[model samples]
Target chain A: MGLESIPVVTQSASDGLTGNAAAVLREIAARLESLAKEGQSGIIDLGAMPLSPADKAWLADKLGQGEVEINLELDGPSHVRETRYAGVWWLLHHNPQGAVTGEFIEITRIPELVLAHPADIISGSESLNFLIDDLC
Target chain B: MREQEGRLVASLAQQGISRRTFMKYCATLASMMALPPSAGIAMAEAMASSRRPSVIWLPFQECTGCTESITRSHSPTLEGLIFDAISLDYQETLMAAAGHQAEEALEKAIEDNKGKFVLIIDGSVATGLDGAYSCIAGRSNLELLKKVAPHAAAIVAMGSCAAYGGIPKANPNPTAAVSVSDIIKDKPIVNIPGCPPIPVVMTGVLAHFLTFGSLPELDKLGRPKAFYGETIHDRCYRRPFYDQGKFAKTFDDDGARNGWCLFELGCKGPITYNACATVKWNGGTSWPVESGHGCLGCSEPDFWDGGGFYKALSMPANPLKLAAGAAVAGAAAGVAISFANRAKKGAAKAAHETTTLADLEK
Candidate 1:
């Protein structure tokens, strides 16, 4: 049979309730609380976890969307979105081929990947000085 | 040792690969290897500063499918980048040098890196006919492996053939092929067993070695526990159907269309341990079971000799006759063995229940 003949079975979000999504939600909650209490940043590797598609949908629904949404174009496209809860962000990284390489949940003020590195800032400062020199 | 060149980070930067992209690649690898998120930064630092590890690939008695799997794995892939980062000193099929020049390159690589480079074996070592079944540059694979395996820091068996004597070592084997482990017992060996293993797995192992300065934690079968710990059945999408006792009897049945479990159709998912279920193939597109076929159990030992691919793993040859015989026997021994049989069956049932409950708890 052709690949197109294969039936696509999409499990409902409710199906996630019977799975490990509740436990994962509880873990996320605990991490979020820790982040608020001690300013501790944490990351949950969603790609490593055996999360079903339904579990992912349930998580997305529960987290809801926040104001901040970012798309990074580097080796590939990466999406960084804030969850409904402050200090909680969802991240998805894809390779240049457009296939997802990793997914994660970060409990922090801002995800680390979105921040500019100090080394880049130093290089930028050098370039700025060079531009001023050329102008003179 | 070869002169210490510029750091990997500087080299990648020269190639237009930024530090941010490198960090992202490290993070992806860290997640894939089930390492802590912070370990991604550590991996990035380690790989950036450290020199590229030398690798010497040795092909033996088999097809070059393993090489194809790694090289042609999704273009501009992180794994591809990781491979590019390595100093592959010698590879037979990929390298341009041939004849004595190729042999000289191999000798030079060994002499330079001796006891430091990673040795990757893709095919099985044929021991039959005084090791004449497979040879390169007038040297038997057996002699070559014996010579090279000693000086390498670690060896990676890259395919089922190199890991467990794959198809060549099947029943009535003519070549008397054997796995790398069977011959090289001293060196640390990691088996990435598959007809052709997933591309990322090879790179993941290499990344782990590069970052940690040692091999990743391996399962009893000498495979990395991160990828090979869970069986295909444990992580399969159709697992819920299997739990509900729904199964497809034939290729085109309604159950098959509904995506029921292929247990009756001889799916070896329950026995095979590999990352195909979750990590998937062809850029995470789909695996064998997802493509509407039973698992061939390529990762397991001696899978070729297990049985016919279409025959159920545990089904009796004649179900109706066996059931009828059991019924008749039960009736004849009703009085004599009933109490004893009930006791034994009750104990067995209790054990079964406990095991099932424990599995559900997990």
Candidate 2:
């Protein structure tokens, strides 16, 4: 099948939560509570949670929106958005073919994926220095 | 003590690291250290005001792999820069001084920074043949460690060799290789055990000490609980597969390509503890399992002797003659018991009569 021909199914409210979404939301809530109490953060794999699109929307709506919103492009474009509830995060990873490959609800002060990788940052700085030297 | 060079904040600013970036680094370090969220801000404040701590690195009976893991492999990293910023009084590999000059430098640094410097040692201490197996400058590693350990405030045993006698101490051990904990009994020692530990772990431990002026909480093996408290399996991305009983039978199988659990392929993640799953390698790029290889459990003691790397941890037990006979006997007993109970119940029901209002009054 051609990549262009593949149907892109964007999740909407109509795609609502799977039956197990309640259990997952409960788990996420418990995780968030512990994070708030213990001062530690952890990742939650929504990919394995078996939630439907509606459930995802329910979670997204429940958490609301926070100040931080980071977008990453690696295997594909990943949306990492923080919720109004402090320290809660919603991460959606799409494959190169534009299909939702993985989804997670990370509960950490800062998600690992959002952080600037040390090696990449170093390389970037080095390249800029080289560019400046060339320009001079 | 070694004199302060400059405050970390000023140095970071000079390196073109903005306050925002520096705070982010501090926050990341705080999270990695398992400190409270607000502690990130506290750490930023502390580190900004504090001077770089003095460190003395000693290498013995090593392959320099640990050094490479921290310095070369993770070069240009903030942690690497933090390592560089420290007052590295002496390091055999990186230091320009050698021969008598090197020995003199080590002595002077120790004298100057007595009871204040952080003594970081890599490699194992060999006791066989009067510790002659490994020596530096005509002195055995054991003797040198004994001499230097007394004056230092804290000792960090970096790498599996230093923490628990790695490959050298495996099988019919000839060197009588012993960990740093084996010899130094008086001082506090932190074991950062791995074939080569994560670079950030090394820096995190240093940062913890710098921030609090004390060692972080340690596990039973004298390792920081923050990093070694949980098994890799618990934090693995493929844990759901393990729970679902889906495993990759072979490396190239469909299950393997689909990122199934590698339990059947001798994955020691269930037993091993480290930050590879979360922190990852090469600046959070990927780890061994992500690259399609089972964990070697290098961080665990005697990992080299933990059976074959490709062999499963355990296989389902086969039904033997004894087991079969036991099963049969158990089934027979259950049948006999149930039969007797049924007979008794049937007899009681047969003999029983329904009671009317008059019988109830009586």
User: Quick one: RMSD of model 2?
Assistant: 17.2
In Å, residue A82's CA in model 2 sits off its true spot by 9.0
What is each predicted model's overall lDDT from 0 to 1? Answer: 0.82, 0.75
Model 1, CA-based lDDT: 0.82
Q: What does the TM-score come to for chain B in model 1?
A: 0.85
Q: DockQ, in order, for the candidates? A: 0.32, 0.06
Please tell me which predicted candidate would have the highest DockQ against the true structure.
1
Could you give candidate 1's per-residue lDDT for residues B115-206 as a string of tens digits?
A: 99999999999999979999999999999999999999999999999999999998657899999999999999999999999988898898
Report the lDDT tens digits of candidate 1 across residue range A42-122: 998888766777889988999999999999886888899998999889999997768798999999998888887666677
Weakest ten-residue segment in model 1 chain B by summed lDDT: B318-327
On the 0 to 100 scale, the lDDT of residue A97 in model 1 is 65
i-RMSD values for every candidate model: 4.9, 11.7
* lDDT value, residue B301 of candidate 2: 85
